[model samples]
Target: MAQGNIGGLAGGMGRFTELRQRLLFVLGALIVYRIGCYVPVPGVNPDAMIAMMQAQGGGIVDMFNMFSGGALHRFSIFALNVMPYISASIVIQLGVHIFPALKALQKEGESGRRKITQYSRLGAVLLAVVQGGSIATALQNQVAPGGMPVVYAPGLGFVITAIVALTAGTIFLMWVGEQVTERGIGNGVSLIIFSGIVAGLPGAVLHTFELFRDGSISAISMILIALVVAAFTLLVVFVERGQRRITVNYARRQGGRNAYMNQTSFLPLKLNMAGVIPPIFASSILAFPATLSMWSGQAAGATWLQRVANALAPGEPLHMIVFAAMIIGFAFFYTALVFNSQETAENLKKSGALIPGIRPGRATADYVDGVLTRLTAAGSLYLVAVCLLPEIMRTQLGTSFYFGGTSLLIVVVVVMDFIAQVQAHLMSHQYESLLKKANLKGSSRGGLSRG
Candidate 1:
């Protein structure tokens, strides 16, 4: 499927310099990001960090390392990745609906959007600072099983340096992502995360092989795991492409011989309009508290913080329940934010179109909202099942199984979105080529007529 998209785009590349440049720019940006992943921060012992991660073994840490393209394991500058930015964006988005001033700003147009974006950026920076500091403090107390400290020189100087390095790395990534969105292809942040996950695939496969060799998992279990992943991938693709189309009919304008014909179109409402955002948001929010608790619990030996961290650990009942609920809630919340039923109804009314058997104003909004609510509920349920099932399976398997449902969902959705964008560019190129040919033909015919 990916090959087909690339082939189609390449077929038309000769006539589309802009698309070619955009693709190249995206490639270059991703390469730059991958390079940054290996650049270690100062004052940290990368070897010790790796040893600590291996000694602790797989679970949340492994998942985070995968997301960071192994930067977390190495304690590289990009260890935070774009998670702080994502968390900050979620807070800002929620604020827009809750605060009157923000809601008004949202209503305001381009300038309002710029203000909101600025706010999100600032929030990201703040979150990055706090998270980076927590990581620095946590590292101070962390020691590998071999008795080597994760940090070479643990002091205020080291803490300050680590915080500065991490925050700078995150800020750089945010800039790269924004540039990609404006000058390249797909979503910058999502693509960054996608690249990290893709880069980790080889390592994950190798680790699984090691496990098999060590007799941690049977061949039959491995086969079953592969089949399950394949099945889930198919399920994700099907559901992501699923949509509910509402038939909209334009009112006839005239009743004479030259009367205008009524036109019919369908409004496509996606099953998961929120895409992979809900899970990302839920993960970010949940991880924030866990990180803080772990930091405090380890540094100060606080019993309460330890209990909180334990309860929120992945695969715990409370963790699973909260995670599922948050996924469903964010699914609804993000869907509402992205697709406003009232706005759609107003647009349709202005264009003299109405849903079949529905009134043209508020009633239309109500009907559309009803349909969307049902679809979102189903979609949210699907998301919860996809995200939680892997955790449950991992618990039962008693082994670290890479490519959990969240990772799989993210991989599939990002690829789908990227391919769709490539196809769009290809279509646009073809349309322009046809227009140019028509213009040339018309000019030639005029010259012949004059002769």
Candidate 2:
């Protein structure tokens, strides 16, 4: 048994080698992204920026920096990362539901998607400019622990330079993500975010250890945190992989001159159909107010804005409550967008497939929708627990834990997706090889018969 397992693993590894070019492309793109993280925006003092971030004491800054792969710490060109793109995507997706023209375009299929993507790119550029300008202007007012200005030349010239540089960087990163998705591995944008979060793991681990060494966090507390993380990771893996298989039966149908017998299959509905998207969307939305308050000197002084920012800060009850709500909301919203019950029912009906006892058409759509609603409700609750529990525990425990629930979820989900894609590619290659071998054998047999 052990030898067979080892032999199977060896064959799998050999098949993985067939995808070397794609793997290399993904690696090279990530390397370029990492390099960009170190290349600071022109005129910003990297040391002063780091000092300011350190002094700010890790709230929204830490969150953004985590997503940026530490680029925000250095005020690098990639500091904005894929955030603007994500926000733009959310906006476009929402618009698809609200606007008639957009809804019509959505039904137009591939060409429509391309147009929507183009719009998203345009929105990303626009958002990047606004955010970059905000960051640039904010840097002019920011002072490090030693009263050092983050921006040496804080003026219109600096703002323009920074804006242009940051916007260009976002566009370039967007292109890289698209390229990776088309030619390389799994979803490119997710991989980029995954690389960023994974990049920060080493430093986060070292920092946690330093805190423990310095007696900032107790040994018992450390152990508890580890246990919580492990439990949550296992829960996420199991739930993410879990699916409700709705069995569908297909009646006999005639195709061409042949009459086909009834068949059975399953329509798999994932427990968490939204995957990591809800948390990402929730985090991005929740961070917006805090980002405004954190960056704007004017907004910081306003009592109302300050109150709002404080209320929404991580670990705050309001923050957790709102975050949970948003996660659940986006989960259902995104899931609905991705899986249309009415459309699915129509397709199934046209294909003469129906759930075990459910009628075809309207009844099937209702039944599927009802099942999905329950699953999404449960899935959303699972996401809320996974995303908020660790933060709540860490806040209560008073540990300087770096990785948040959102980061962990993204890492795990992306890794699973990447592995699944790799396996799929390998299987496809093996199948093609088998077909070619069979064809070659048939050709040889035909040649011998002719001889």
Candidate 3:
């Protein structure tokens, strides 16, 4: 019996080993990404950029830097992060709906998808070049609060080198993401972002502790902030997993010799279907001007531009309102793009499934639309609350915690997804074992019958 138990444990351990291998592959890819973050773009003065970033604290710039895992502050090769790729994807998605040719390609399935992806890649490269050039130009003009240069050499050579390095870094990241998806577990791009956020946690925690030691924040405030973070994390888990189940009844049809009756199923619509994309998009869009303004030194002619930029700075009241609005709007917009009520209704109708008390076509579509609208509202509110809570804490409590709602949400969601994937692999392994046992038992019974 002891031997049998040992064998069972070994079998279970083997399954875990398989899962561990997959996770190791993912971890390896993430290590590569972190290494890339440290590789500076050729010709950049790392010391100068770091000093400038340290001086310009709290604003859209800070937010973007956080997303890039401090690489932006270093002016590293991966300073651009994956923003350009995301922007390209958004543009392509929009084009697929508006442009007839792209729409036709979208309808063509896998091959069309490949073509669209190619186009998106090209678009990403173009955006990276533009954004990189913009950043390089901004660096030349931007001055630290103490009148220090952010860039050592402010010439065409530096600009060109920075742009090329940044663009190449983004493309390399795109490749890394693809490799992770193909060879490892978890969505590659999401995992990259997840890793970045997780990496920053240590520094953010250290900063919080420093603030406490310096008496900048009260002990009670630290407790309050912890409580807020825990509450927000729990809230995000709830809303992210929250779903509305729409019941559907399918009337079965008769086959050659048998008659079939009705069956029931449910359609699950997640409350936060758009996930964290909206906040990222909204932040990136707003950060553009602020980033440029910081780069441009807020010169005499651009004084008005600087004022507007400051007003729209992250953590400010007006900026928060606009950011919130943009988040809500994008949540709705992206939700519509991914979930088409009309298409869902038509597909269900074609499959002979209909929601009880609703017609198969237009009425069902309307019902779905109504439900989605309500769900989106709830989701948007949850997002706003999670996002704004941290900002409020920063303002009211004088806490130095750098983790924001967007980062927390992404980290939590990605972790949940990673866990689910691992669990699924384990479940499959268990099922296989059970099947093998059943087959062995059947074979033994057959042999006994022969004896």
Sorted on TM-score, best first, the list reads 3, 2, 1
Query: Worst lDDT window (10 residues) for model 2?
Result: 1-10
lDDT of 1: 0.85
Ranking of all predicted structures according to lDDT, beginning with the best and ending with the worst: 2, 1, 3
Query: Candidate 1, residue 4: CA error in Å?
Result: 27
Which of candidates 2 and 3 reaches a greater TM-score? 3
Clashes (backbone N, CA, C under 3 Å), per candidate, total 0, 0, 0
Candidate lDDT scores, in order, read 0.85, 0.87, 0.84
TM-scores of all predicted structures: 0.88, 0.90, 0.92
lDDT of 2 by residue, 390-442 (tens): 78777776876666878988888898899999989988877766665567668
In candidate 2, the residue pairs with backbone N, CA or C atoms under 3 Å apart (3 or more residues apart, or in different chains) clash, namely: none
Which residue ranges in model 2 land beyond 4 Å of their true spot?
1-18, 254-260, 297-301
Kindly list the per-residue Cα lDDT of model 3 for residues 202-244, writing each as its tens digit.
Answer: 8779888988898888899888888888887788888888999
